[model samples]
Target: MRDLHNRISSPSAARRVTGILAAALLCATALAVPVTAAAATTTGTSDDATPQLANGLALTPPMGFNNWNSTNCRAEFNETMVEGIADIFVNKGLKAAGYQYVNLDDCWALPQRDSDGKLVPDPVRFPHGIKAVAAYVHAKGLKLGIYTSAGTKTCNDAGFPGALGHEYSDAQQFADWGVDYLKYDNCNNQGVDAVQRYTTMRDALAAASKSTGRPIVYSICEWGSNSPWTWASDVGNLWRTTGDISDNWSSMLSIFKQNAPLAPYAGPGHWNDPDMLEVGNGGMTDTEYRSHFSLWSIMAAPLLIGSDLRSATQATYDIIGNRDVIAVDQDSLGKQGTVVSSVDGRWVISKELADGSRAVVLFNETGRPQHIATTASAVGLPGRSAYKLRDLWQHKNYNTAGAVSATVPAHGTVLYRVSADRHWASYPPAVEAGVSEAPLVEAGTPVPLTTTVTNLGRTPAISGSVALGGPQGWRVKATSPTRTAALSTGRKLTTSWTVTAPAGTASGAYDLTLTAAYRSPTGDAARSELATIAYVVVPPPDGTSYVSDLTWMSATNGWGPVEKDTSVGESAAGDGHPITIGGTVYAKGLGAHALSTIEYYAGARCDTFSAQVGVDDEKGANGTVAFQVWADDALVASTGVLTNAEPAQALTADLTRAKTFRLVVTDGGDGGDSDHADWADAKITCAA
Candidate 1:
C-alpha cells in the first residue's frame, strides 16, 4: 500500500481488460457472495435489499476521521492511536461539526487468523485487543470504524481475513467488537467482480446488524473501476468514484473533475467519493486546502478527513471545522453539485440546499489568480432577480444583481450561499452581459454584445435605461430595447452593442462595461446596476495558428481539452523552466496513453510545420510525455518521448495536402506521473 494513492491510475494489465469490459457493458448486476452462517443475509438486488432494513442511517454524509488519508497503512495502529483520534475529535470541536467515527483503515490484524479461523487484532499492535479501543472511543462519545478487504487478503498483503468466505463470521466479529463503520476495500481478490464481492459483504453486515442489533455504515472502496455509482447506492453509504487522490492540487483537481459528472448518482444514502480529504497533510498550502474543502462540500462528498489531527495546525482545524461549509454537505436537500461553467481555468459549481438557497463555489485552477465571473443563468440561478449572497468563508454578505463575480487566488476557492433577496431595496435588479461570438474573435472583427437589465426586485422600475461602454479606440455603438422603458416586475430591458478593436489590438481578454439606471415608483433616482464582460480577441488564423486560443480547445479540459500557456510547471503551479518562445504561454494538455485531441484548421496552405515538446517537470523527471501530430486522425509525426529533465524536443510533420490536423499529447506510459506535458512554440510556416 506504499504510495497507493498514485496506484489508482496505474492498474495492472488484468484490471485494465476487466475494467474496460465492465465499463462497456455498464454492468449493474452483483454476483451473490454466499454465506453459510445461519444469521447472515444472502444475496439480493441493490435497491430493495439490506439498506432498507437499516433505514435512515447515514442520512447525511458521515463526517469522520480515517487513518488511510494520513497514515496510508503506515501508522502503528495500536489502542493508543485510536484513543488519541477520539480525544482529538472531541477536544478539537470536530465532533460538534459532525465529525464522528474514528476509522482504522487496513493492516490492523495479525499475519494469520487464530485456530478458530476468526479475525484477531495483532497482539503486538493491540495488546489490549480491539474491544478496548472501541470502549475508549465510545467513552469519548465517538464511534469506531474497522477496515477489511473484499478480496482474499488486505491491501498490504497482511494475509488478514478479507471476509471472502467468512463474511458472516467477520461481520459478526466487527459488530460484536462495537464497530460503527466498515471501509470494505478492493484488494487481492483474484479477479472477483466488485459488485458481487462487495455485495456479499453488504448482506453479511446487514445480517449481523439485524442479529446483533449493531448498525454499521458500509463504505465500498472499489476505486470506481466498475462504475460503482451505478449500483453502490443500495449497497453502501458511499463508494469511491475515481482513483486515489494524492495531497497535491493537481491530484485533487483531477479527482474532482472525474467525480463532477457522477453528481446525480449521489443522494441521502450514497455518495460519490473522490478518495479521502487530504486536508492538513502538509502536501498543499492552506489556500489549496480551503479550495479542497469547498469543492468537497459543494460535491457533497464524505468528509472523512485524512489528516494527523493531533499535529494539525489551527488553519487546518478552521478549514475542516467550518460549520457553514459542512451545512452544505449535510444539507437536507441531499443533492450533489456539478460544474456549471468553466471560464479561463475558473470553474463554477452550484448545489441547491434544502432551504431553496444555492451553495456556489468559484474555483480557480490556474497558476495566476483570476477574476471569476458568470451570469446568474450560468449557475441556474434566477436570472431576473437579485440574490442576497453570503460569503461562507469570509462571513460577508453581498446584494448581487445580475452577474456574480469574485477574484480568486491561484488554486483557491470562494464559497457562497445564494438566497433570494425578499426585500426589493436590498436586493435590486441586475444587468447581465453576453456576446454573440466566441471569446476569441479575430482582430478587427466586430462582435455584437448584449446586456439585459432585469428587475430582480420585489417591485418594478420606472424609466429604466441601460448605457453600455467599452475600451476607447474600439468603435462601440449601443441600442436599448426601449429608452426610458418602465420595466414590470421580473421583466427585462435588453440592450445591444457592436464593437470592433483596432487591427493591431493585442490578443487577450478585453472588457466591456455596462451602466444601467432606473427610477423608483416614487419618481426618485434609484441605484444603478453595473456589469463587465471579458471577451478574448485573437489574430487571424495564420498558417501555424496556436491551438490554446482556439475555440475548440481553450475553455474545456480533461480527455480532449487543451490550454495555451507558457508555464513549464508539471501542473498549473508554474513549475519547470521557462519553455515558451516568442510568446507568453504555450499549448499544453494531457493524455492517458490515448491521444488528447487538438484540432488545427491550418488548411493546405501550410508548407512547413514544427513544434517543440517536452515533459513539464524539473529535468529528468521519471514520467514519460510525448507529442504527436495527426492528419485526419492518421498519425503524421511524433516526438517519441520527453522526460522532465530533458530539453524540449522538436517535431516536423508533412502537411502539403492536409487542411486539418490534430495535435496529440500522451502520457507515454509509466502512468501519469510528471506527465505535465508542453508543446512549446508549436508553429507552422505557410507559403507567404
Candidate 2:
C-alpha cells in the first residue's frame, strides 16, 4: 500500500529550532523499543483450535525464491530471470535443501486486460507467454507463483489490472495456466472489508481447484494492516504480518520485534509471514544477514530468497542454504520460537522441536560484543545434567552442562540445537570468543584492540591464548598477557593488542581476524575465530570542498545506493537524474532518500558545514522530508520540514573539534513513499 499524502508545515521560521530539538529527542529514544517477556507468548488462544487450511499444501512454511526485493518491476524481471532462478535452484544445493517454488512479483501482467476480460502477460517481459514459463519451471521440478492485487489495480505505479471483480475468471485462468501459487496483495481496495475481500478469492481458488484438480498456494499480502494473522489462517497459506522489508538492520530488527510475539498464530498450513528475505542485498554486513536468517527461521516464517541468485555471493548462499537452520523452520512441530529471556539488548529465544529437542538463539542487538547467557531449564528443556549442543553456523558439536551462553558479536546470532543426550566426555569444550569494535583511526596511528574468550562447557579450557591479526603491512603486538591460566567453566579471559596501519594505507574498511586457541581437559586442541572490520580515514581537506567530492566512511540509504550528484533513484546505482530541488538543478551535492545516513571523517579539522536542502524535484510535488546535520553525536542543525512544494532552505552546522560528521534525512512524520532529498551546494569549510 502507498503512503498517505503529505501535510504542509507552518512557514514560521521560529519553528525550525524547536522542530530540530524535538526531532533530536525523538531520534535518541524512539528506536529503542525493547522486547519483553510479557509479550513473548500468545494468550487467549487454545492450541487445539489453531486454524489450518484443508488444502494440505504448505504443511511447513514454503521455501522458495521471489523476484520482488531484488528486481521489482524492473526490466530484468522477465522470463529469462525466472528460468535462470529455476536453473540455479536445480544446479545449486537449494533444491536439495528443500527450496521448491520460483515466484514472480508484480508488473508481470500488461497494463490493461484483454478485450475478453482476461489478463495478458506483458509480451516484452514474457515473450513466450505465462503457460510456457510455467512449463519451463515445472520441467525443473519447481512450482511457479504469480502476483496480483485484490483491488482494481496492482501496487506498482504502472496501474496493472488486478483480480477484484474478476476473481472467478482470474482464478480459472491461473489454474488453466498451471500456476501453483498466488500472492494476492491489498491495494486500492476502495474501502472494502478485508475479510470479505480475501474470502472472495479463497472461494474462487477453491472452486477452481475443484474443477481443474490443481491447488494454488494462496499468500495474502495485506501487509498486516488488517491484522491478517488473527483471521487469515484458513483463507491463505501464509499472510504477511508486517509492511515491506528493507535491507537494513533497523528495518529487519523492527520487523523481528513485531513478528516474534505472534508465535501462537503460526502453524503447519497457515503462517505469519514477515515480508521476504534480503540476504544478498549490499545494504548490511554478512554478520547482520546471518542474524536475519536465523531469526526468521526461528519464527517459522516462509524462507523466500529475495536476491538476484544469478549474481549472489558465496556468503549469501552459505547463510540461506544452511540445511540445519532450514530444518528448524520445517520441523514437524510447527511451533514458532518465543523469547525465553530478554535483558537490555541481549535476547534468548527457544523453539521446541518435534524430537524432544530445542532450537535456541542467543541474539545480540547492541553495537558491541555481549555475553548472553541462558540455561537449559529456562529454555523449556528437560533437566538433564548435560546437553549436546550443535552450533548451526559453525556446524560443530560440543557439550554443555546446562549453560547455553556465548559472547555474541554486535548484530550477530549464536544458534544451537540442544538435545538432552549426555555425551559430555566425548565432546570438546565450548568456548565463545569475540573481539570489540576497532576504533576509527588515521593511517600510521596505533590503536588498541580487545578480545574476550569465555568457557561455557562442562570442563575447563586449559592453556588458553588469544591472538589478533591485522591486514598486510600492518603491525600487531600484544599489549596484555596473551596466555591465560586454566579457564574454568563460566570464566572469561580478556586480551588486548596494539595495531598500526601502514602510512600509505588508503582510506576504506579493512578486515581483521581474532583467533582464540585452547585445549580441552583431555588435551585436545581447539580454535575459534571471529572476523571484524576496521576503518582507515583520510584527513579533512585544507580548504572549502564539496561534500560529494570527499570519501565517506559509511553510507546507508532507504531505497537504493546513495547518489553522488544526482537525485535518489530506484534500486539501481547511477540511475538518477541531476540534483534538482523545486525545478532548480544544482551542480554538486549528495542525493539520498529518507531514512538515510552518510558519515564522513571530519577529523576535527572541519569548522563549518552548510547546504541548501529540500525535497528533490525529481519526485514532483509528492514528497515531504527533513534534513539534519550532526557533529559527532550531537545535532548541530536541522531543517524543520521541506516539501516539494517549497523552495530550497539553507542549513549550517558548527563542527568545532568534531571527529565525525553525519548527514541524516528522514520522512517528516509521514511514510517514505517519494521522499527524494538532496543536499544542494553542500560544502565543508575547514581550518588550513
Candidate 3:
C-alpha cells in the first residue's frame, strides 16, 4: 500500500531555538519547493509578491488528513490508518476528487533530536526513515505534510525543537526529509510581536523551500490576533483565522462568523484558514457538516481535512468533496465571498464566482429557526430575465422567477448558486443604499439607543458580529439577537444597546464606530468600514438639585417587630425638595429575607451619592445596599420609577435627592427575632 508521512524538523535546530527563547516556539517547513535565492517582501507591501509552486506540484487546494481532531498522541501515528487513507484516496475515487496532501498533525516527534541536531522520527511508529515513507506516498501520487509551532514546544508536548529563532534550520531539516506541507502553530511565549514572529518563520520557509528545491505550503496558525486579514498574504500562504475549531456547530459558526471581516484578503495562493474541518469527528450532524462545507467553499478558505478519512461515512465524503461547490471556491476568477447583509442573528453572504455565477448563503445563529427571503433585485442581480438557482446541499435546481426565500433552521443555513441570463437588460432595483444613524445621546445617561443597518451590496452578508464604540465601555446593553445577527440584502434591521459610563469617565466627544463583519461561505471575509458619528457626554448640572431615593425607598418600610410583609409608609412626594434617606430599621421577617425600599425623585443632577447603614443580626447575613432613582411628578406620571434591586454591588445610581426614602428590615427576623439598624453618611451634592 502507498504511504505518506509528515516530518518534524531536526532536533538540534528545535533545541537551540527552544532553549534560547525559554518558551514554546511555533514554526513550520514548506514542502516540495524549489531552492532559489530571491528577495521576498516581509513588510506590508502592495507589490505582487505572491507565492508560486516551485516544484512540479501545483496548488490545487492541498487536501489530505490531519491527526489533531480524531486522536491525540496517545497512539503513535497509526501507520495502518495513514496507509489506509492513502489507499482510499486512490482506490475509492478520492484522488480523482482532487485529494492529494496527506498530513500528520502534532505529536509524532521523539523526546530528543539526533547528535547532529536533526529531528528523529519516533522509530517505534515509523521503523522507516521519513524518506522511505515519502516514497510510499509519492508512488500513489500523493504529497506529505507535517506540523510545528512558533513556540518552544508543539501543542501536543512533543520535543521543543524551537523554530522561533531556528526557522531556517528547521525548514532545511524538513526539506532534507522530503516534506511537502507545513502547519505552523503559535501556542506559547509572551510579548512576542506576532507580525515579526510569523514573518521570521515565513522567511525561513522561503529559504528552506529554495534550499530543498521543493514546493511547500506554509500554513500559519495564530489565534487570529491583530487581524490576520491585514497581513496574511504577506506572511504565509494560509493563516488560521480563529482559535482551534471544535467538531461542534457552535465552535465552527463562531470561527466562521469571526472570519467574515477578513474575506477581502483571500485569493489564489493566499487563503484565510478557519482551522481544520471536523467533518467526520462525530461532534456535529451531517447537516452541520454540509453547512460547514458550504460556508467554507463560499469563503474561499483552504480546505484541510482534520478528521480520519480512512473510515469516514459516505455522507461526510459526499459533503467534503462536492464538485460543484468546490468549483465555486477554486474559481479561476479568484473572487471570494463578501458579507452583504446581517440582522436578527442571521446573515446573508454572497460570492461572485469566475463562471459569472454567484453563490449566496443565508445563515441563522439565533436559538430559534428563521425564514429569510430576497428577490434577485435585492441581491443586486439583474432581473430583466429569470435566472436558474441551484441548492448546493439539496442537489436540486429551482427557477427563482421572483423572490428568493427559504426557511433557515436554528444555527442552520441555506446556500444557493445563481446564474444570470444574458438576455436580461434592465431589471428591478436591487438592495438598498446609504447608511443611517439613530438618535445619539450623551454617555453616563440612563438611555438606550438603537441603530438600524441597511444592506446595499450585490449580495447578502452571511452571519457576523456588529460592534459599536463610543465612550469606553459603551456597549449594546440590549440587542434583539443579543450575540450576532444574520441579515439579508436590501433588508433594514435594528440593534439596540444601553449607555453606561464607569466612574471617573472623562467627558468628551467620541466617535460611535459600528462594524458588521462576516466571512464568505467561500471562507473569505469582508469587514465593512468603521461606521462613525460623534457624540458627547455633558457633565451633570451643579446646584441644590432635588434627587430620588428609588433605590431603597420603593421597598416596604417599617420599624422593628414589623411582620415579613408590612407596609409602614407611603411613597413620599418629591415636591421639588431633595429628600435625604437616613435612619435604618431592622426587619423581624422570617428566614434570611431582609429589608426592601422604593423611592422616586427629580431634578437631582448628581452622579455620586451614597448612604451607609449598620445592621445587627446575630444569624443573618451581611446587610444589603441599593442605589436607584425614580421619575418625579411629570416624569414619574409618564415613565414611572425605575427601581434597582437591593444589595448594591457598586455605588452606581444617584440618591442625592430622594423623594420618600426609607429602609425596612427584610431578613433575620421572626415573631421573636430581634435586631437593630442604624444609618449615617446621608448627603447629596447636587451642586454642579
Candidate 4:
C-alpha cells in the first residue's frame, strides 16, 4: 500500500506557479468566482447519460456515525468504542433523531488474510469478531458499516488485504456478518478506473444481498478524483465529491465550494458526499460548526457524525441532533440546494422542500458581521405578499413580507424554512435591526454608529423606536430620531448613535445590543434584538514590539490554533516548534496555516509593519502558500506565492493611520495541503 503521507502533488513548479497567479487574481477581485445556478458539466463526463441506482436504500442521504475524524487508526478505535457509540446513539437521542449506523473506518482487520482467503478481525481489537459486534449494534436498533479499499490493499500503513479481485467473497462475508453499509475507499488501486472498480463492488454487493436477503448501502470514497459526480450516481448510493476533510474552516469551505456546484447531480437515491461531518472535532468553534452542519444539510449530503461520542459535549450533540436541520437533509423532495447568489463571501443557498417550502441559508464567510439579504422570488418561491420564516438554529418563527435578511455573524450561518402563507398578517410585524460601524475604537474616542430597523412583515409597523446600549461605563446616545409614526412594509428607519468607550479601558471585545420596539397596526406589540461586538483597543507603547507579543482582536486559522512565536502545528495550541521559514529559525513571529487571518486593533497609532513570510520548513518541500497584509479593508502588501523550496520573502506595509492591521495567508489555488505558513521576525512600531 502507498503511504498516505507521501501522496502525489501537482508534479511541477510551473503548475504551482500558475495556481498561485490565479489565486492572486482572485484575491484582487474579492475572491470572486463565477456562480452557477445549476450544476455544470464535469470534466470528461456527461451528466445527461448518468444512471441512477435502484437499490431501494438511502432514499435520503444516510444519517450515521463514522469513527474516522475523531479516532482514525488510534488504539481506542476498537469494538468497545464502536459499541459505546451505539449506546450513546440510543441513550442520548441521536438514534431517536435519525442517526442509524455505527460505522468502523480503517484498521479494523488483521495484517494478513486467513488461510481460506478470508479477512480476519484483529483479535485484540474485536475480541468477539465483527459478527458479534454487528449483533451488539443491531441489538441497540442501529446498523453497522464497515470499511475497505477497492485496491489490492487498504489504506493505512498496516496494509490489510483489500477487495480488489475478491469483491464477491468479501461482499458475501460482509453480508453474512450482518453489515448494512460499506465505505469503499480508493487507495492502492494500481491505477484502475474509478468507475469500473466501484461498479464491480456495487455488483458484488447486489449479488451478496440477493443471496443473504440483506441490503447494503454502498459509499464510494473515491475523493472526487475522477469527477465521480458525473457517473457514480449509478454505482454507489453516495460518492465523495472532494478530498479528505480536515477539521478546519478552510477544508470545509473548500469542500462546500466543490460540492455546492454539483447540486443538479444529486437526488433521492444518489447523493453527492462532501466527505463526513466534523461538527465536534474540536478544530472549530461552535459558530463554525453550526455553519458546517447547516451547509451540509442544505446540500442534501449524508449526515455522518465524525466525533468521539463517548466524550462529546452537549453542544456537539445539540448540533448533530437538531431535528429541524436534519429534516432539511432528509427531505422527501431530495432536491439539493442551489446557490441563489454568492458575492464577496456572502452566500445565499435555497433548497426546495416537499411541503411547498424552501430552506434558505444565509452564510457569512468573511471575518466580521455582515448583513445578508434576499427575497422569496430570488430563491424560486412563488410570488406571495407574505411568508412564514422559521429560524432553524434559534428555533423561532417570524413573518416576512417577501424579504429574507439577517446580520449573520462572522463564519456563521442563518438557516430558515420559508413558506408562503396568506394568513401571515396575523403574526407580529418582523422588524429586523442591526448596527453598523467600525468595530475597533480607540479608548475614550467616540465613533458614529448607524442602526437600521427594517419592517419586513406584511403589516405596517407603528410607533417604531430603536435604542442602542453598551457596557455600564460606556456612553451611548442616539443622534437621530429614534421613533417613527408609521413604517410601511419593506420600509426601513435608520437611526444614528454616538458611542464612546471609557478611557483606560482594557483592549478586548465588548458586547453591544441594538433593540427595536414596535407595534403592529392592529395594536400588537413586537420587539427585535441584535447583539454585536465592539473592540476597545490601546496602542502599543513607544518603540518596536513583536507582533506575536501584542494582543490580537481576532484570529482564524486553517488548521489548528494560531501559535505565538512558533511554527504552525496540527490541530493543537502551542504544539508548534520555533518559527522556521526555509530552514531559518526565528525567535519572534506568528505561526499560522493557509486560509488564515490575524487581526490587530492598531488604533491608528502604528507607523509600519514588517515580516519575513514563507511556507514553514517544518513541512519540508511539500507546502505552497501566499502571504498578504491589509490595512483595514485595503490590501497594502502581498507576496504572490511562496513554496517550501524557496527562501523567505520580506513583506512590509505602511500603517501610518490604519486603525486595524491584518495578516492573511491563503492556499496557492491547488488546495490547502501542508500549507503551514510563518510570519517570521514580525514587528510593529507605534508612537507612545
Candidate 5:
C-alpha cells in the first residue's frame, strides 16, 4: 500500500501475463469455485466483460477523503480518532460541503481471516468487529472505505485472505461487513497485468455489491502505469495518475504540474488522483496549502484529503472548506485545466467552467519572482468579449475590461474565475510591447532581424515608443529597437539597430525586455504586450566542413542528408541504414534530390555501369536537379533532366527510359546545400 503512489513505467510482470491469459481462464476458474454471484449485466467480449460494471461505479467523480498522509500505519487506530474525525466533519460542516466518504487506509485489517476464508478483524483492536465499526461510521451519515490487495498478502504482509483464489468469498465477506468502498491495490501483486487483476477484483466487488444490494465504489491504485487515462473507464471509479505526493511544496507542485496535461482524461466518475492532500501534514504553509487546493481543483482531480482530521487546525479547516474555491473543482462541466503558456519554468493553466467562466492559474515553479502577462485569448477567452475576474484565493474582484495582465509572485499561484461581461470598454487600456526575437549575438554570426507586436484587444493599440532593455554589459547596437515614437491604432511598428556581440555574453538565449509604455489622449498611462527578445550569444564559429550523421549525397562516394532527402526511388523516405560508396557510380538521369536507385550489381565490374535513379520532388516542380557525369573533365551521356514534380517509382535500367550511362549529380553547383541536390541509396537493378 505504501507504493500506492509510486509511479510505474510498465505493468508488473504479473499484469502482462494476465492481460494475455486471464480472460479465458478467470471465469472458467471462478465458476468452478461454486460461488453464487450476480452475472455481468453489460455483455461484451471476455476482455471487456467488466466495463459496464466498472463504469457504473465511476459514473461521477469519486469524492471522499483518505487517511494515509496524516497518519501512516502508526498503529494508532482506535474508536476515539475515527469518531473524533467523523465528529469534526459534522462540526466543520464538511459533509454538506461534498466531503462524504471517510476511508480507513492500510493497517486496519487483522493478521488473518477466519476458517471460512473470511478476513478477520483483530479482536484486540476492534473489540466490536469490523461490521460494528462500519455501522458506527454509517450511523454518522458517512460511508466507509476499506483497503485490500490482489496478491496473496496485504501491503503489510498480512495474509491476503481477500485476493485471487478467495476473491468470491472475500467479496461476500466485505459486503456482509457493510463496506461501501474498496481500494484494490497493485502492491504485492507480482507478475500479473495489474489492469486485469484489478478488473477481476472489481468484477468480484460488483458481484458482491449486487448480491448485498449495495453500490460499492472501486478504486484502481496503479500509479500512472500504462497511463490509465486511456483505460480508466474500463478499470475503476478513479485511477492514480502520478507518483506519491509528499508533505512538501516541491512534491505537491511537481505532482500537480505533471497532472496538468492529463486533465482531458478526467471527467465525471473517473478522476486523476494527485496522490493526496498534505494540508494538515505539518510540512507546508497555509498559502502553499491554498495553492495545492487551487491546482488540484483546476486539474479536476479528486479531493481526497490525506491529513489528520482530528488534529487539524482552524487554518486547515478554512483552506480545505473554502466553498468559493471548491466551486471550481465541483464545476458541473468537469473540464480540467490546461497549461496555456510556459516560460522560464513557470506555467499558466486555464480551466473553463459550466457557466462559461474561466479559471486561470499563474504558477511560478522557479525560485525568483517573474513578471508574467497573459491575454484572455491565451487562456481560451476571446477578446471579442470582456470578463469580470474574481481572485478566488484572495477573495477579491477585478475588472478585466479589455486585456488582463498580472505580475505573478515567486513560487506562488494567482487563481482567478473570470466571467464575460458586455461593459468591457469602460476599463483603461493596457499597453504591452515585446521583442519579436530576443537579440542573440553569435560572437561572429549576424543575427536575423525581425519584430512583431499584436494589439490583443477588442480595440486597436495606440502608437508608443517600444524599446529593448538589457543588463549593461551585453547590449548589441544592431539588435536595438528602432526609435519609432508613434504607432497607429491596432498597428505595429518595426525598427532595427546594430551592435557588436562581445566575447562572452553567455551561449544561450538572453532576455531583452521590450517596453512600449505611453499615455492615452486623456492623459492616462498604458503599456503594450511585455515582449521578450531572445538574444542568442554563441562562441566563434567552427569553420570546419564537419559532416552530420544525417547528411546524404547524390554523387559517387556520397552520403544522404536526413533533413533534405526523403527517399531513393520507391524505396520510401527514412533513415536508411548505412550506404557505403567504394566503387564507380553511374547515373541514368538527373535526380530531384530524392532517393534514387544507384547500383553496383552483386558481382558486376565497376566500369560496366548500369544504375537507374529516380528523383521524387513531392512538392510540385520548382528548382529540379539534373544529373551531370564527369570523368575528371569529360562530359559523358546526359539525358534531358526530368522536371516533373511527381514522385518516381524505382526505375530499372530498361533501355526505353534509361540507356548505358555513367556519372550522376544535379546540374550547376547543385544549388548549394540550401537546394537539395543529393542522392540517397543509389542502386543498380539486376535480373535476380
Candidate 6:
C-alpha cells in the first residue's frame, strides 16, 4: 500500500538525485503518474494533522481485527490465538477481502519486564514468544500488530511496558519480533506532555523501521485527548478521534458524529480513527452493522474488525467482505465523508471518488423505514447530466432522470455509485416531497399535516399543483396548494393542512396521500405522489382495551437515553435503556434507572395501575436502587432495591384513581452502579 502512494526511491543517493533531475526535466512525464488524494493529504498537509506525529502507513484507513471488543478485559493474548486468527482469515475468505493485520490489543505482555528491562510475552499464553507468533502470522500471509501505552503503565493491569523511557528498546524489540503495526495508547501518562511523549515513540518507530528495514503502521491511540488530527499525521499513519465504541448503535453513531467532521484531517496515511469495528459483535442487529460499515466507509475511517474471527457468522462476513463498500473506503481520493444533508432521522452523505464518480449513501437511523429523496444537485453531482446509478449492495442498476429516492429501512442504507456519462438528451422534472405529521391521532381531534414539495428536476415545472388528499369524512385544508407549482428547479413550496379525524373513525392505521403534478411543454401533465403516510387512528374508548398514549405524557425524561420504544426488544441493546421485566416483552416504559423519570397523566377515564420492574445488567454486580410509583402527590407502589440479578418484581397500585401518575427511578445511594432498572409492562388501565 505504501508503494502504491509513490514510486520507490532507488537505494543509492545518486539514483534518487538522477530521478529528481529527470522529474525536473520532464515535468509532464512526471505528472503522468498522478498524485493520489491520500498521498497529498498527509495528516499535516492541510486538514487533520494529529497533535502527535504519525508514521504514515495507513494511507487508506487500516483494515484488520483487534481483540478488544471480543475479549475485553480478560483476554489471554497469546501466540496461539494470533496464529489461529491468521488461519481463519484464509479459510474464511477475509484475507481476500483485505483484512491484513492480526492485532493484539492488550494483556499480551507479562506484568513485569525482563531482567534487562525488555517487554516479555506472557509465558503461559505465548511460551514460544512474539517473534514466533509473528512468523506464523506472516507465514499465513497476514501482518502482526502489537499494542502498548505512552505512559509507565497501561490502562489495564496488563503489566505491559509503557514506551516512555524505553522507546528505543521497545521499537527495536518490536522490529526484531516482526511486528508490522503498533497501537501506541495513552494511559498512566503521569502529567507528561502527550505530544512530546507520543512523538518520542513515533520517532523511535521510524528509526526502528529504518534500522530494521521493516515498516510498521503506527497508530496514535491517545483517545483524541490532544486532538491528534490537528498534528498527528506528520508522525503516525492514523490517530484515534474519540474514545472506545460499545457494541451498540447509539455509541457507534455518536463516535461517527465525532469523527466525520474531521474528514479534512484524514488523507492517505493520516486517518481519523474512530476506534475498532464491532461488526460481528452480538450487541447490535445485522441492519445496525450494515449502517456501521456504511458510515465508516464514507468517513474514510479504518475498518479494523474487533470481534473473534473463529466463530464469526455469515452476516458478519457479508458486511466485512462488502467489496464495493470497501472500495469506497479505500478510494484513492482518501476523502472522508461528512453528513451533507440530514433531517427527520435521515442522513445523506457523498464522497468524491478518484474516478470522478460520487459515492452516496441514504441512511435511515430511526426505528422504521424512511422515505428519503435527493437530487443529483443536492449530492453535488451534475444535475443536468445523466449518470449510471448502480446500487452497490443490491447489485441493481437504474436509469434515473431526476431525484433518487429510496425507502431505507431502519438502521439500513442505500449506497449508490453515480458515474456520469453523456447518454440521455432530456431530463425529467422531478417533484420530491417530505410529509410531517403526528404518528398517532385520536378521533375528534385536529392534527397538523405538513408537506414540503421541491422541484428537484433540472427542468422547470411551468404549471403544476401540490395537493393533500385524505379519507372522505376527514376535514383537511391546505395553506398554499399551488404556490410552488410554477417554480424553477431547486425551488420549494410548503403546504400545511389541519386534519381532523372523523368522530367515529375506527382504531387502525390509515394512509394520507401527498401528490404533486407538473405540466410539460408539450401540454402533458405528470404527477408524483406519496400515497401512504401512515397515521394511527385511536379508536373510540370502549368499556375496556383503552391505552393511555405514552406520548401524551406531560413530561418524560431520563439519563443516558429516554428511548421511545416503537417496538419491543429495545432493551436488548444492553445500554441499560430498555429491558424486559415481565410476562410480556414490554418496552414502552422506563428501562435502566440512572435517575430517569416518565411522568404521565391518567385523565378522567383511568382505573388501575400496574408495572413489572427489574434490573437488566446481569453481567455486573447488582446495585441497590428503588423504582417508586407515584399517583399525583401520593405514593402508590414501590419496588425496593431492584438488584441487578433479581427477577421481575411486580408493582400494582390501586390508582387513587388520580388523573396523573409518575414513575420515578432513584439510585439507592450506591451511585447508580449497575442499576439497570426496567419498568416493563407499565400501563394505566382505563375502562368505563
TM-score of each candidate structure, all chains considered together: 0.64, 0.82, 0.56, 0.90, 0.56, 0.63
Q: Top model by TM-score, which number?
A: 4
Better of 1 and 2 by TM-score: 2
Which residue segments of model 5 deviate by more than 4 Å? 1-51, 54-60, 157-162, 402-404, 423-688
Clashes (N, CA, C under 3 Å) per candidate: 11, 0, 96, 0, 52, 26
**What are the per-residue Cα lDDT tens digits for candidate 4 across 1-688?**
1222344442222222333233334323323454343444433334565454578899999999999888888899899999999999999999999999999998999988999999999998999999999999999999999999988887776678889998999999999999999999887676677778898999999999999998999999876666677677778899887667778887688778767867877888889898899999888888899999999999999999998888899999999999999999999999999888888889999999999899999999877778999999999889987898888987867788888998877788999999987677777777778767536777799988888999888888999998888999999988899999988888999998888998999888787888889887779887887767788877776778999999998887877788999987765688999887767889999999877889997878889999999998878776788999999888999998789999889999998889888998988666536788999999999886
lDDT of 3 at 124: 73
Q: Which of 1 and 3 is ahead in lDDT?
A: 1
Q: Where does model 6 exceed 4 Å of error?
A: 1-56, 73-77, 423-688
Q: Is 5 or 6 the stronger prediction by lDDT?
A: 6
Error in Å for residue 300 of model 5: 0.8
**Candidate 6 residue-wise lDDT, 351-425, digit = tens:** 989988788989886544577877666777765544566677765443355566665655678787776645422
Q: Candidate 3 lDDT (Cα, whole model)?
A: 0.53
For model 4, the superposed segments whose C-alpha errors exceed 4 Å read: 1-52, 441-448, 462-486, 493-506, 517-525
TM-score of 6: 0.63
Q: What would the C-alpha RMSD of candidate 1 be, to one decimal place?
A: 10.6
The better candidate by lDDT, 3 or 5, is: 5
- Give one digit per residue, the lDDT tens place, for model 3 in 505-547: 5443344556556543344554533333333334334643222
Off by over 4 Å in 1: 5-54, 157-159, 376-384, 423-688
Q: What TM-score would candidate 3 get against the native?
A: 0.56
- Candidate 3 Cα errors over 4 Å, as ranges: 1-43, 46-61, 158-160, 189-192, 422-688
